[model samples]
Target: MVRTLRTSRASRALRTSCAARPEYDSAPTGGRKSARRRTGTAVGTVLALIAASAAWVVGAAPSADALPNGLALTPPMGWNSWNKFGCNITEQKVESVADYLVSSGLAASGYAYVDIDDCWMAGSRDAAGRLVPDPVKFPDGISGTAAYVHAKGLKLGIYESAGTKTCAGYPGSLGHEQTDANSFASWGVDLLKYDNCNDDGTSAQRRDTTMRDALANNSSGRAILFSLCEWGVDNVWTWGAGVGNMWRTTGDINDSYGSLLSIFHANVKLAQYAGPGGWNDPDMLEVGNGGMSFTEDRSEFSLWAEMAAPLITGNDLPNSSAATASILGNRDVVAVDQDALGKQGVQVSAAGGLDVLAKPLAGGDVSVALFNENSGAATISTTASAVGLPASSSGYSLDNLWSHVKTTTSGAISATVPGHGTVLFRVSTGSATSTGTTHALVGASSGRCLDAYDNETTPGTKIEIWDCNGGANQKVTLTAAGELRLYGGTQCLDATGAATTAGTKVELWNCNGGTNQQWRPNADGTVTGVQSGLCLDVTGGDQPAGNVNGTQLELWNCNGGANQQWRLS
Candidate 1:
């Protein structure tokens, strides 16, 4: 979506009297708030301040007040108009797209909503102060369009701004929230994408919460899916769960590989903030938009599904290429996105422009994505145990979502992915289990062993690397549950803080079967943590002299350095 304000005669006329100034229509880059001046009338300003203060106090922690509208239990899959058609949308275009969604089998695969983005409304409100549909663009009006889409067993979504004027300079619903909401519900709108433009400097939480309440208490009592487009400012993901069904976690995404990669890096880290009723939106999909290659487009779809992001397509459906149709229509990939488990995938391994993501499913299955962000083909690999599966000696099944090829691996899952390409797989572990083999883990570089500091045997004792003297403290067992057990299985190697990031300290903790304590001894002689997907390093792995005795072990990116390599002996 274009970020700058679009000034039409109608928008210009309306802006002349409002105290609020024009800003970028899209979210500010780098998660920074816009610098545009904000102003409102005396009463409006005072009330906004009060609401901001109240939200700041009550929203100090993540809000649990997610709308109980019972929609978007899984990220809503649909087609939006902003990315492709932009302000060129029309009733015929929307209706045609709805027909294509059904005829092309997209709706059967879960692409249900046909949403109209910005510029769908008239330049000004009607005489009764309610928003009006653009006469020329939506000739049948929103209600008529909704009826047509509903007749096809699909839903209709509409857009509005939470400011005095929309980014496109049309009248917004800032102060006219309830009135606009009543209009939307009465018109059969099933969803609302609320943008942030020409805002009055009130806290984003306050503005979004106001609209959330208005939609909830609207006179029609319709259950409208709330989508917040604040562009990630004010840390929307922190408390967005209670405010909207989904909240944008980054700026608008263009049809480019760089934009997709950048947004992926930003949104993937916020997996903890997304779940059943709420989700972290990385903006709509730009697949089939032609800015990126077919490989890149597929990568975008795979990564979004891997992240459990809302699969709202922003491309023209009728004229899309077969490659686009195949990518978007892959039921296996879509299943991962619509998995009943509702868990967002976490990046288990990322190094040298190669990344591996793993998401657990509801029925003992796991979906993994091996993404190569480099400019050339690269072989990316991860073990079954590394992706939260038990090290099954009987092997695990890997179903390639894109290729429709099935393969089995004893433990290793590897693929040579092209540049900007993704290898998506659904891994299923049968009855295989980890072996209870006990051995001293000898560091490949230091020739030292994994040890509990000072033989403390405490829950939080530091796990370090020391001389391999066959001591009891150095003996570790690989348990069936994917844990490294010490002291006769009493203590397990744990990534402190349950952290998934690198440099997390390894500690001795009681085996509670938490993912943080899961360890996988890979065939490459590297001991990796299932939770962090990081290697058990001897600290300072890149040092020239290698690690010293008593150097505490921490989780670090798997760089194949000697310090990160371990041998079970």
Candidate 2:
């Protein structure tokens, strides 16, 4: 069954205990009706009390419009309790997991956060209206557990809903956001997995932003990573970077190969939304879970790393097998996920149940994954040039991340991947030419070359589309500094005013190596500006018949149209 349809054991117990309370009747229901049913005068009274508290001083609160807390510089690598222990979590179990994370070498390998996922709280709030840890389940309280985790040099994460009740029927932080944020900050929580269950009809953005502001304004002066668990509704990725460190792009993941593959497909396309402080979370890792085969588990880990998804393992680490440990502790594979460049892998090609993905790493290395999704083994192949490595006569070095075998490839990056398996390689382009490679930037739709208007060498000359006549003005060189140089390396293609908005003009300027002049040639045959993230376009090229010689060039949204596509010929 899908994870969303499954209820935790603690939720059932909470339902039985709260049967007499009308407000608790809406624990399972979400949206508008549930909001009206659960939030009565008591919620408003509690908010009023919180607002009147000296802690709510207006000037101290961080701006709600501020950028996300700079916590997860890379996609978070950790373990969460929901997928395995669920609502059965206890202080001892959490402490034990922290122990295993350190002792099993996973911590040293990069897994850090030991996250508690729901049901650790009592059925009702205390008389003071503060959340209380269940005395039986968490004998030492959340603060004690966090202290234990912190002692082990790790961080602790806690889960709560944005509505009146959590998915597992625990009291959520919806209207009680500031109170709960203060409680979490006091407990020394390092991360907050804010779930979307049992939410009021309020817009997800507003509710999430409310809690984000609450967390920021907490008096403890702590920086907690905010993880939005809205399950991809409302295009969370589009605004998640400004609100949270990582955002879920799909529903909860189960321990099955089909679930893994579906989530991978759902998340791989969101590469542009992922970066240093924010990530596209495809739910937690099920590596040690029994539903998938060894090959499938390895494939899931490899793909998640390639896509730069948070490596939050959701399994019993203490009792995990040696193979599971090896897979989870593979330093080479983990390095790709934690690469400093923080570029998520993009699908280079996919067809016939075979796929190739490429991620650019810091220092000119690219991580390539050859995946076979069918029921049998197959050979998947792509060239170094196809994966965005600069062309070179000396060839590239391919380091098989999983096998730890090194080999040299003149250009081809092919692998015979088994069914439901992935062959991941780190392709080093150290031997590739670094000074520059001159080529004609030919527009795929217009069949014209990128040219300076009137062959002008003056700065601020408009770049335009013209017939490919092999002239010096049309010859562009991609350099090691990421600049698109023209006019015999004296002039560079630049986005006007370093603007990031669409329709920014492309102009020729002296080569001073500004970010506006930096261009990245994506595998999809589109060139994007480093500062703007906009594609080089032949004006009106979306309409096949509109583009002509002397048509102006501009930076526009990447619509995957033929007009935005280009060839470095």
**Model 2 lDDT at residue 212:** 91
TM-score for each candidate, following the candidate numbering: 0.66, 0.66
Summarize candidate 2's per-residue lDDT along 1-569 as a digit string, tens digits.
Answer: 13342234233222211000010000111012222112222112112222221220011222233255757887888988867776678999899999988765677767899998878999999999999999999999999999999999999999888878887677989889999999999999999998876766676789889999999999897899999987777888999888888898876677778888888889999999888888899988888666776678888999999998999988777766433554676667788888877889999999998999999987788999998999786889999999999987778987766544345778998876667878888898544332366877766445457888777899999998765657899898878788889977889999999899999999999988789999876533467899988989878765534455667899998765556756454
Q: Which 10 successive residues of model 2 have the least lDDT summed? A: 18-27
Error of 2 at 555 (Å): 59
Over 217-334, each residue of candidate 1 has an lDDT whose tens digit, in order, gives 9998999999998777778899999889999998778888998999999999999999877899998888767677657787899999999999999877766543356567667778
Residue 63 shift from truth in candidate 1, angstroms: 12
Q: Provide the lDDT at 38 for model 1.
A: 24
What does candidate 2 score in Cα RMSD to the true structure? 23.7
